[model samples]
Structures are given as C-alpha cells and as structure tokens.
Target: MKTRTITGVFFIIVMLASLLTGHYSFGAFYLLLGLFCQFEFYGLIKKSGYQPNYVAGLINGALIYIAFAYTANTHIVQPVLFLIPVTLSAVFIQELFKKSTTPFQNIAFTILGLMFTVMPFTFFHAMAYVNGDFNFHLPLGFFVMLWSNDTGAYLTGRAFGRTKLFERHSPKKTVEGFFGGLLIAALAGYILSIYYTEIEWKQWISMAILISCFGTLGDLVESMFKRSINVKDSGGILPGHGGLLDRFDGLLIAAPIVYSYLYFMAT
Candidate 1:
C-alpha cells in the first residue's frame, strides 16, 4: 500500500511538473513516455508470440511525435512529415528478409503499435499547442478530469456497485460507477472552467463527458488486449501502477478524440 501510494504521488508530481515547466519539457517528457509505452506494447506483443519491429516502430514513432510536436509549436508542417511513410515502409521491407512465418502479422502489429501508442501521444502533445500557442490549460484540464473520473468510478463501484458495466472485458466496473465517474468528471470540468477561462463551462463539461465515456472504453480495450494475451499487467515500470501503458491507456483512446473536439472548437 505504501509503495503504491508513494509511486502514485510521485507519478502525479512528475506529470504535473512536466506540463507546468514549459513546452520543451512537456514535449520531451511525453516524447519519451510515448516511446516507453510503445516499447512496452511491443514487449507484450512479443510475449503473445508475435514479433513487432521494435527498431522501426520506435524510430518512426519518434519521427511521428517530433513531426507533430514541431507542427504544433510552429503551426507549419515541416518536410520531416514526409519521412514518416518512407520510414514506415521500411518495416515491411525489413520483414522480407526474416524467416518468420507470420511476417504480415509482424508488420500489422508494428503498425498497430504506432497507431495505438504513438499517434495518441502525438495528438496529446499537440493539445498543449492547439490554440496556435503553448498553453497547458487544456491538457492539464484533461488530466484533472481523467483522474477525477477514474477515482470516482473506483470509489463508487466499491461502495455501491451492483451491476456490471462490461462483464466480458472488465468485471469490476459497474453502471452505477460509470455515472459516478461522469458526475465527478463533470464537476472537475466545471471547476476547471472557473480557473481556465479559455473554454466555457459547457465545453469543459462536454469534454468531461467525452473523457468519461471514452476513457472507460479505453480501459476496457486495454483490458481486452491483456485478456486476449492472458496477462494481468502491461508492465511493472511503476511499483504500483503496473506500467506506463496501464496508466495511460485512457489517454491513448481519449486523446485523439478530445484533440479532434478541441481542434474543431478552435477552428
């Protein structure tokens, strides 16, 4: 218990500090984080008897993130964006020389790792610069609401959960807990609107709704992935949190959807 609590607190501090420090730190931190998550993902895939091209995946993942971050910061697309497809194509070519029977499966998993782990971080990092400038409010608010939802769901489920939300993927989650999380996330969003006046309260609440719904879906999706492979945790990088991917699974699915929301709202 002590270890979990201490690790959770330390994790929160590092995440908040990275965002609050500056754009450069924020970019660097999440860039590394995204890579780590991708690495963990590839590790899990390997355990399931599949081989994802770690080198190509990580290299292209870095390139994709850096390209997005650069575009987000400068509001100008760079030539490096063109290098992604070119580099990614090399994965398929590289697999041709390998003796693996599941070459296409390897290729697919490699691409899936990029889409699942890398692209979301790219969208999330872009969130800080969504408004033609670097402002941490939206991204910060996102974490706040996401954490709120997770806490609310857990507490409410433990106290009064009677019905399962998704028995196949997650047995512990409850319908009642889902509503509990929605309420808490909405409140968090409302509170964020009070301080971060860049977006109105309704918009914040709507974002909270999106987070609650999609974040839960993301958790279930990750759970399904683990169940498919018959594993318990993604990794043990954190003492209590299991892995970086385990901690950020919600962000993986929610970030892109929320980014689209913020992007459309801004435009």
Candidate 2:
C-alpha cells in the first residue's frame, strides 16, 4: 500500500508535469516509455518459443517513435498507415536468414504486438502536438479520465464487489466495479470538460465511456498475454506497477480512440 501510494503519486506528478509542459521534453518521456513497452513486448513474445532480435525490436520501436513523430513533426499519413505492413514484411524477411525456426509466427506476432501494444501511443503525441491553445490540454483530459476510472473501479470494487467481471481472465475485476468506475469517470469527465476548454460536454462524456469500456478490455488483453506467456506481471520497471505495458494497457486502448475522435474532429 505504501509502495503503491508513493509510486502512484510520483508517477502522476512526473507524467502530468511532462505532459502539461507541451514541449519536446514530453516527447522524451514518451520515447522512454514506448521503448520500455517494446522491450516488455519482446520479452512476452519470447515466451512463445521464439526469440526476437533486439535490433529488430529496436527498429520496430523506432518506427513507433517515428509514427508519433510524424504526427508531431510532419504530414506523412500514408507511411503511418503503411507501417505495420512494412514492419511485418521486414520481420518476415528477417526469418529467411534463420534456418532454425519458421518466422511466419514471429512476423505475425510482431505485427499484432505493435498494433495492440504500440500504435495507440501515437495518440499521445498527436494530442501533445495538436495546434491551438484550447487543444493543448486534450491529452491531459484523457489521462485524467483514464486514471479516475482506474482508481474509482479499484476502490469501489473493493468496497462493494459481488459479481465477477471476467473471472478467468481478470479474477479481481467485478461488474459492480465496472459500473462504479463509469459513474465516477462520468463525473470526472463532466468536471474536466468544464475546465479543459477545447472539447465539448458530449465529447467528454462519450470519451469517458469509451475509455472505461476499452480500457477494461485493454487490461483484459494484457492479462491474456501474461496468462499465455505464463508470467505474473509484464515487467517490474515501475515500483508498484508491473511494467510500462501493464500500466499503460488502459491507455493503449483509450489513446487511439481519443486520437480518432480528434482526427475526425479535425477532418
């Protein structure tokens, strides 16, 4: 408990400070986070009886950074959409040199892993780099909503949980907790919408629901990965939080949704 409280407080403080600063320094923070996630992902895939090249992982990791950088620095939509295919092909080609094991599964897993684990992070970059004073706070709004939902569900479920949400996948999750989280998240959305200037009330509420549902799904997805890999946690990079992927699993799902919302709004 003490570890979690201290870790959580410090995590929030650092993340908020970096994000709210609205500068290239936040990019540095995200770059480190994304790289850690990539490392964790490579470790997870290795459990399936395959070894991913660090160079390959590094290349793929850099692609994620570049994709996010495009949103921040340039206008390269076509390459962004084409990244997964390109990266998958590269992985496939790499398999040919290794006469030991079939690379098809590795390629497929790498592609899927990037899509599931890495792509949504680009949204954070997009949010950070979005032009206009009002738009600057959008990412922070998503962060607050995600955190609120997480905290609310945990506390409420502990207090009044009866029915399990997904016992096989996530034993601790509860339907009661899900709804409790939504309720609090909705309230947080309302308040944040009032304060954050750029987004609409409906948009905020809708985003809150999206984050709650998909964030839970993200947690379930990570849980599935850990279960399949026969691991308890993703990694122990964070003090009380398991790893970058473990902590950002919810954000992984929510970030893309938030990004899409903004993208469509832009178009």
Candidate 3:
C-alpha cells in the first residue's frame, strides 16, 4: 500500500510538472509515454507466442506521435501527416526481411498497438493546443475528472457495492460504484468549468460523464485482455498501479471520443 501511494504521488507530480512546464516538456513527456505504452503492448503480444515486428511497430509509433506533436504546437498542418503512411508502409516492407512465419499477423498487431495507444494519446495531448497555445485547462481538467471517477468508484463500491457491472471482465466492478463515480466526476467537471472558463460548465459536465462512462468501458476492455491472457497486471512499472496501461486504460478509450466531442463543439 505504501509503495502504491508513493508511486502514485510521483506519477502525479511528474505529469503535472510536465504538463504545466511548457510545450516542450509536455510533448516530450507524452511522447515518451506513448513509446512505453506501445512497447508494453508489443511485449504482451509477444508473450502470447506471436512474433510481432517490434522494431517496426516502435518506430512507426514514434513517428505518429512526433508528427502529431509537431503539428499541434506550430498550429501548422504541413505535409508531415503524409509522411506517416510512408513510415507505416515501411512496417510492411521491413517484415519481408524477418524470417518469422506469420508476417500478416505480425503486421496486424503492430498496427493495432499504434492505434490502441498512440492515436488516443495524440488526440489527448492535442487538446491543450486548440487555442494555439498550451492551455492547461483541458488536459488538467481531464485528469481531475478521470481521477475523480476512479476514486469515487472505489470508495462507493467498497461501501455499497452489490450489483456487478461487468463481472466476466472485471469481477470487482459494481453498478452502484459506476454511478457514484459519474456523479463525482460531474461535480468535478462543473468546478473545473468555472476555473478553466475555456469550456462551458454544461459541456464540462457532459465531458465528465463521457469520461466516466467510456473510461469504465476502457477499463473493462483492458480487463478482458488481461483475463484472456490469464494475467493480473500489464507490467510492474508502477508498483501499485499495475502498469502504465492499467493506469491509462481509461484515457485510451476516452481521449479519442472526447476529442471528437470537443472538435464538434468548437466547430
């Protein structure tokens, strides 16, 4: 328990520091995070006895993240997006050199890793740059709402949990706890809307609901994967947190959907 709390605190500090520091740190931090998540995903896939093209997947993921980060900061939509396909094609081309048997499956998992981890992160990190600058409100508010949901769910579940939310995938989750988390997240969103002022309070509340709902689904999805593999945690990097994926699973599912909402609202 102590180790978990300490690691959690350390992660929060680093995340906030990097986010608030400036664009460089923010970009660098998420870029590194994206890589780690991708690496971890590929590692998990490898354990399943499928030989994924590790180098190709890692390189392509880095390319996708860096390209998005570059375009986000400068607010310049350049030809770089085009280059992603060029690198992605390299993934297939490089597979020919490998002596592995399941070339197509390898390529598929490689791409899946990029889609599952890199894409959402790109959208999530880009949220802070909609105003042509590093506005902390969107990203910071997201974390607040997400953390609120997690904390609320745990407490509420412990206190009044009865009905199973998704027992097959995640046996511990309860329907009562899920609603409690949503309520808490909504409250946090309302407060954040007041302080951030970038998004209306109503929209912020909606965003919180989305975060809670989709985030829970995301957790279920990860749980499903872990269960299929007969594993408890993704990795041991975070001590009490299980793994980075265990921590960001909700963000993985929420970020892209939330980005779409914000985009339409802004448009």
Number of the top TM-score candidate: 1
Model 3: per-residue lDDT, tens digit, 153-178? Answer: 99999999999999989889999999
- Pairs of residues clashing in candidate 1: none
lDDT of 3: 0.89
Candidate 1 TM-score over all chains jointly: 0.99
What TM-score does candidate 3 get on C-alpha atoms? 0.97
List residue ranges in candidate 3 displaced over 4 A: none
The per-model lDDT (C-alpha) reads: 0.94, 0.77, 0.89
TM-score head-to-head 1 vs 3, winner: 1
User: Which has the greatest lDDT?
Assistant: 1
C-alpha lDDT (0 to 100) for residue 91 of candidate 1: 94
Using all chains and alpha carbons, the TM-scores for the candidates as numbered come to 0.99, 0.89, 0.97
Residue-level lDDT of model 1, residues 20-121, one tens digit each, is 999999999999999999999999999999999999999999999999899899999889999988999999999989999999999999999999999999
On a 0 to 100 scale, what is the lDDT of residue 240 in model 3? Answer: 81
- Per-residue lDDT of candidate 2, residues 188-231 (tens digit): 98999788756688878887888899888988988998898899
By TM-score, the candidates rank as: 1, 3, 2
